[model samples]
Target chain A: MNLPKSVSIIEVGPRDGLQNEANFITTEIKKEFIQHLVCAEIKEMEVTSFVSPKWIPQMQDAAELIQSCYSSIRSIVLVPNKKGAERLLATNCKSAAVFVGVSNRFNQKNINKSTRESIVEIRPIIADLKSKGFFVRACISTAFYCHYEGAIATADTLALCQEFADAGVDELSVADTIGMATPAESFSLFSTLKQQLPNIMIAAHFHDTRKMALANIYAALQAGIDRFDTSAGGLGGCPFVPGATGNVATEDVVYMLERMNIKTGVKLDKLVKAIDIIAPHLSRKIDSGYYQLTKKRDISV
Target chain B: MNLPKSVSIIEVGPRDGLQNEANFITTEIKKEFIQHLVCAEIKEMEVTSFVSPKWIPQMQDAAELIQSCYSSIRSIVLVPNKKGAERLLATNCKSAAVFVGVSNRFNQKNINKSTRESIVEIRPIIADLKSKGFFVRACISTAFYCHYEGAIATADTLALCQEFADAGVDELSVADTIGMATPAESFSLFSTLKQQLPNIMIAAHFHDTRKMALANIYAALQAGIDRFDTSAGGLGGCPFVPGATGNVATEDVVYMLERMNIKTGVKLDKLVKAIDIIAPHLSRKIDSGYYQLTKKRDISV
Candidate 1:
């Protein structure tokens, strides 16, 4: 199984992670978290989301959080709609992420829009962002399976991916938002996407719900995908999906990649320290296996 | 990637998992745990070890546990040396597991014998067991990396495996006692072993110390390994090796395989219920991801 010499990890803790957290992280702590992550050499990160504060009150300070997190690394923000896009425009950040669910039921439940409607609705926003020189990362939520709709058709997911690519999106992210994918499904889906869209950059975002996230990441790597969306301390889960776990822990992924001789451009011990900074602020225990292992270092090799 | 249509799981939780617990589980509870696992259609299991009670107080009732767990399923017992082997010989159990670390330092520390000496000592024991109609599972601990000696040479591991095969052992088990093997290494090791010993059944026993156990299993499956040693509720760890996590949770592995449409003759829900039976009895928190996921059933897919 051939793999890339180096892999790029896009940390999504601030937005995807903290959003699922019950306790609102103070703006100062969020900024410190980002600063520590940048110290660990994370070049790309989703600093926060631009969704309406009324819906996700925790992200109420999205603009302020972004303003506070001044870093050399690329700062990407989640934009759920044209309003979110407009809010992102006022910020200094030049990168934004938009989403359209492959499962129509999920789209309806998550964004109150159909999958196609989400695509149609986000098209102008994506174009608007691009016109202003913003890099757009179009994410397909429930790319593998949806809690509401069960298994998603590969052809349908590919069609959504193709729509995003045609919209001139800078990147495409296939997300297992519900964390229901197996390694076989991950390998087949990502491999087919890579083969079909050789020119388009594809990224994988997996959840640890079923504990297959890292395994899925490994399979995707074998299928030639080197970019991933991860969260520090293994934070984040969907508020909509039941029993959904957090994203593949950044620490665990980095450990696996570094051990395999695949460069991740991140320091393991430093990353764990970064996790330590935000762990106490969170409402729940950190779920990253690597983080857990580090805490019990007394028993380790 | 090609995978087997079905796989066989050898449950090691009762022996490997319990052996590491600080609290001693009663023989009656162990018997009940074994019965529950058998209800889940688990055909193979390590019921307990026959080591001296003085060294491993937890397994003091190994003979009584095995005698109580009388069933059609293949109940294997761990035998450390000739004395343990003689004790197993007196029991109704017809299968026994013997192990030697490929890393000499680990062998010395774990078994108080060097690798070569341990092999020499077990040669006659294996022959005697075979003559007495006992099936022997020769395990090579630290097949990937050793906690005491660091990296174990692949050649040394393979040489030990070759010796066991020549001794007419019924099966060969390559173990990642410290969970240090990567997918590439797991694939390479198992693929090479399968090629060389086409007629011998090869089983993999992995600890989840680094959280790569399931990923390693996935890679090994691709390499044509059909039999695995798993623990129900992910129970297991090396008492001799510090920082080693439990085996890859049997429920998690079964979930992955069944999702991929590979049959394991085990029911996921039933297995979880079985784990619930032993959860309160465990001294520490259950280490299986699947077991933990089951606790928060409110967020499931």
Candidate 2:
């Protein structure tokens, strides 16, 4: 019952959401989607990633998309390496995100490197970003469970997060990458992180593969963490992770938070509208609960 | 973190799940479905309802279905009135469930009576059933939010549950009939109920309309609730409530419970098979998290 008074929603639909989409959405429509999210009052968002277009053709327009985003919002672009970080620096984006999976197998499969090697490579990148007065967000992927490695050790995840904290990253976005985390694990992990590293901002990112994303977010809230990374219309899944599905839907998160009397500074009606921009372009149906319910009412009316 | 070590799942797919299906499943199929649930080790089940065939023709074979179920499992039948109770009395079923809505408007629309009137009619029936040594479960519907009346008063729901407890019902199945209750509301209401009616067995029934059922269940668990009403493959919704969807899936519930180290005494893999018997006849797809994930894995393999 002792939940936070308010929480921040870090929208990731344009980046994490659309990255795995098989059908390529035009740059214009992606911009329109980001605009709708802005009008919904999303203060922070991962607009796109600066990774190689060969890896994720869906994100080929990353630079063009990030350049078109509203400067008023904190637009974050994922940086996979020094080259990706350089690409981010070329753009007007002030916030950059880096990722390292806790599991060695997942890390190797994702970026052809071990967990230790990835951390070693990214440590200087984060420090350099901080020195350049840029906001750095370390995306700790597979923090709770990995698709290849199974249930991750809490100690290993905490150690990886501590490495990012020491690297002067402004925030840490810990993810339940395969969506296999229970609320108990979410509470236990986040509680320790919050207690151990009290000053750094921490955001809980969850996938909806098992439909426990909202429940996980609720547990994180109870653990005294207020920031969340959500995708619009519950779009996006990890292409590298087999059976992985969408991120927790943005509209659903806002609805749950506002109902609990916790302010998110995001408009539900407008947020739902944002999903409409990209829903038709995708191969999958908009399966987010709130979005489907809204469409049902639309059809019934 | 102070969760119960074990929980009981009351399978309601037979009655609550199939009652709304437009297609009439054969009596033999219904019996097979119940048999599969028994294989899953479901100790309690709401087998069928004894309502008029004109209202719910799918349950027209209620008596025949109940007679075919295993006597080892606790098979419950829904008895709406004196006539239904009389029908139940004719069978070997030992448990009977009766229901009343907390909202007067919802009550009037559902059964053409006010909440108080429905309660008055059911009070004597409950007493009679208790005298006959039949186990009685009072389903308090619209306990949190009503589709017709918007948000329901916590005080009104508590008072209705208290009336049922005093009527000597063995258990109370409190429900968010419209699938609109928040986790905070679930925790607060159940906390108060557990405090006030400490001796009466209370179970939480949630619909996955907004995909918040699991979160609400987690919250209810935090409030010390160890019993839940779930449907196989996430079947069932209130026929009278517009836009209401499936009950929380039993497999998904068992997955979450078992993952959190809380026992439900039900085999999830076998429980999933129970859905196969009824899935083909359902109007909607089996959209429960765990069920869909299993199907996805099946397709991939």
Candidate 3:
């Protein structure tokens, strides 16, 4: 029952949420979505990814999206490799996010590189970003389980995160890539990470594919994690991870945290409104519990 | 992280799930649904209610359905008052469930009785049923929050449960009728109930109106609770609560518990099959997370 007094939510709907979307959303709408999130008091977010348009055509306008976003917000863009990092250096964004899967097979499928190779390539990039006073967050995908490889060994995930921590990253966002982690697994891994890497900020990113996202978040909170990566309207899934659903919805996370007396400094009503901006653009229905409840009933948060 | 090694699940989909449905399912389908749950190793279930046929036509065949169920399973029938209790006695059913809401306004709207009136009337009914060797479960509705009265006082809920415990009910089923209870509220209320009434068997019932059911369930588990009231396919919502959704799905709960290494003695794949029996008959789509994942992907549990 011991929980933090306040938690920080890092919005990921614009990037992680929309990357898997097949339909193209215009840069204007994406900017408008980020503006709505800014009004809702989201201080940090993963706005877009600097990747090849041929691979993920959805993020073709990453540079444009990052340049147009409000400079007051700590907009973080995903950089997959040295090329992506170089692409990010040209943009106005001061924050950059890099990722590597814990599973080699998943890494091979996602970026066509082995885990060791991605780590070796990304280490110097992290140091370079830090040397330039850039905030670098390492997103450790499949930290708990992988779609290609079954349950990930906790030691493997911990070792991978240790490498990133040693590389001078500001934070580590460990993810349940396929959303198959149980609360026990979440608590076990995050508690170890928090113990070993006490100086580094660790955020828990979860996909709601199995509907255990909130429970996993709660476990993470018990392990003293305060930062979360959430999607608006529960949008986004990994195109590489089959049957994966959206990240835990921002509105849903805010609702739970506020109800628990944990401060996220986000307005629930305004947060719910942000979902309306992007819900229609997506091919799937908004599956967020709080959003759907607000639509069906006249209840105020 | 201290949790029970195993948990028991009481299936409420047949009665609590279907009572609110406007469409009537045939008695044969209801029997087959119960049979499927039995095959999934559900040892106990709330099969049906003995309310007036005019009010809930869905349960008009309560007696008929219970009579046809497997005798080895513990079948519980809902009895609202003395009349419902008398009707339950007419059948061969040995278990009866009675309910009272914590909010007086919610009680009046749901059953046309004040909270005090309902408690006063049901006390002797519990005694009478106990004297007759009938196992009784007293369902405490709005244990955390009420739709009409807003957030309910934990003291009010505890006092009402105290009355039932004094009257010798076999177990107490504490419910979050509106699904508005947070994990903190759930942990605070249930932990007190567990500490105060240490000798009694207590079960947690949650509605997924806000999608915090699983998190609330996890909080309850941390508070030392091991029995839960779940619905197959996430079926059932209070017809009286305006925006209330279904209970936490049995399959999802089993998936979490089994993954956490907590035994529920329920086979998830077989439990999902039970949903197929009644899902087509319901007016709304099944909203369970695990159920949706199973249908979308070929991944085996």
Candidate 4:
């Protein structure tokens, strides 16, 4: 209960968010989203992903998003391979995020490679990125549970955590790909990862599918992992999964951390205003607890 | 992180819920809710409050809510005074819950009496209920922060907690009256309460207004408090404040606990189904996060 007073928040709405949406956002809207993310003053924003357009056509505008971004922000781009890393490296982006899936079936189902093959493929990509002197953060998906292969063990995800650490990735964030973790699972996994790789900074990425995302973040905090990935207005859902919900709402996470006397270096009212800007463009309700609270707060105030 | 394998959930939706709603629910529907709660196999349910109908017209049916029960259920009724306690004692209710706000200002605002006067009132009420052979649980409201007077130090709520324990009450449920508590504040209060009165069971009542209710519950659990007060579909908005949300959602609590491998003695699916019965009666959207998750779940499955 007695810990350092404040923690940092890593905002990932622009990148992790747009990648999961089915509709391809216009280059202008994607650019605006990034601008709004910057306006929120969230220091570590993951701007875009350089994955195959064929796989996730929604993010085909990655280059334009990066090209259009303002220079005052510190952003990280998700790059799938050396080609994507090479593409990202061409830009002024100083950091790139690499991904690996814990479940073999999920890796094959999602990214068109076996788990082992993906790790092998990622090593060179990470090495090349590191060699380029770009800050690297590795992401491991399905760390909690797999859609194709149910409940994953803590040891499985910890092994990949070791692999990422071995890859010399500066930071690692575990993604609850299918939103299947309990608070206990989240705490146990993060504690194990921290124990094994203390030098590697850890971030949490959670889907709000079962409404356990924020709770999972809370659990991770207990395990001493403070950084997190959240989407503005809860923008994206996995189209492949019929009923998956959006990512953890950035506003909600900030609201929680701020009230807990934890600092995330973001202004809440401005974040709500930014979410309001993005709400009209989305087809669904803003999947955020904060959006609702803020909306109510606005009317009441 | 590695503690008890499971935490128990106590649902207080019907009593805490119906008492706060603006609409008048008939005795028949109240009976249906009781039947539903029993069908859900919820181990503990706060069915109604034994307060003066003149002051709280919404809770006029406290005696009927327990008397007209169509199901075999162990019910607890909130008692505000000896008269109300005498009335509820006539019924088969197992426990009588007495309440007093910890803050002098909140106690005055909520019960129209100072802390000492409220305790003086609850003493006779608790003694009478105990004499009648009814189990008793005491609730201390505004234990964290008050809307009128923010910054309630842990010492004040702790002093109230000890008073409840000394009163020979069976359990104590602390409430964040205006949804103003952070996890740190909740942790500090609950840990101190457990340290002082380990035998007096502790439960939590939280509002999701600030989006910390679930995490606040998590913090309380880490502080070794298990039981909680929750409203199905997050039904109650504070009547005094009008449109202000109150009481954590029962469904969200079940979702968090079940995922954590906690045994709350409540059926998640049945609790989900109970939402339907309550949602239509609601004039506004239910604030429960699990409501959206469950709706998606039913459609997907």
lDDT of model 4 at position B278? 70
- Which lDDT tens digits does candidate 1 get at residues A1-301? 7899999999998888899777788988888888889989999999899998877989998988888445598899999998998888888899999988999999998889888888888999989999999988998899999988888999999988988999999899899988889999999999999998898889999988777887899899989999999999888888888777788889888888998899999987788888888989887898566788778856452
**Which segments of model 3 are wrong by more than 4 Å?**
none
- The global Cα lDDT (0 to 1) of model 2 is 0.90
Clashing pairs in 2: none
Looking at model 1 chain B, which ten-residue stretch has the lowest summed lDDT?
B292-301
| Tens-digit lDDT track of model 3 for B196-277 | 9999999999988888889999999999999999999999999888888899999989999998889999988888889998
Name the candidate, 2 or 4, with the larger lDDT value. Answer: 2
Residue A135 lDDT (model 1): 84
Stretches of candidate 4 off by over 4 Å are: A22-24, A54-57, A297-301, B5-8, B52-58, B68-73, B108-111, B114-116, B286-291, B297-301
Per-residue lDDT for B51-135 in model 1, tens only? 9888889999887888754568988899999999999888888998899999999999898999889999999999999998988
True-contact fraction in model 4 equals 0.40
lDDT over C-alpha atoms for residue B285 of model 4? 82
Q: Which ten residues in a row have the lowest lDDT in candidate 3 chain A?
A: A292-301
How many residue pairs clash in all the candidates, one count each? 8, 0, 0, 1
RMSD per prediction, one decimal? 1.5, 1.5, 1.1, 2.9
Candidate 4 chain B weakest ten by summed lDDT: B292-301
What's the TM for model 4? 0.91
Rank order by TM-score, top first?
A: 3, 2, 1, 4
lDDT per residue for candidate 2 within A5-33, as digits (tens), equals 99999999999998988888999999999
Candidate 2 segments whose C-alpha is farther than 4 A from its true place: A298-301, B298-301
Name model 1 segments beyond 4 Å from true.
A68-71, A299-301, B298-301
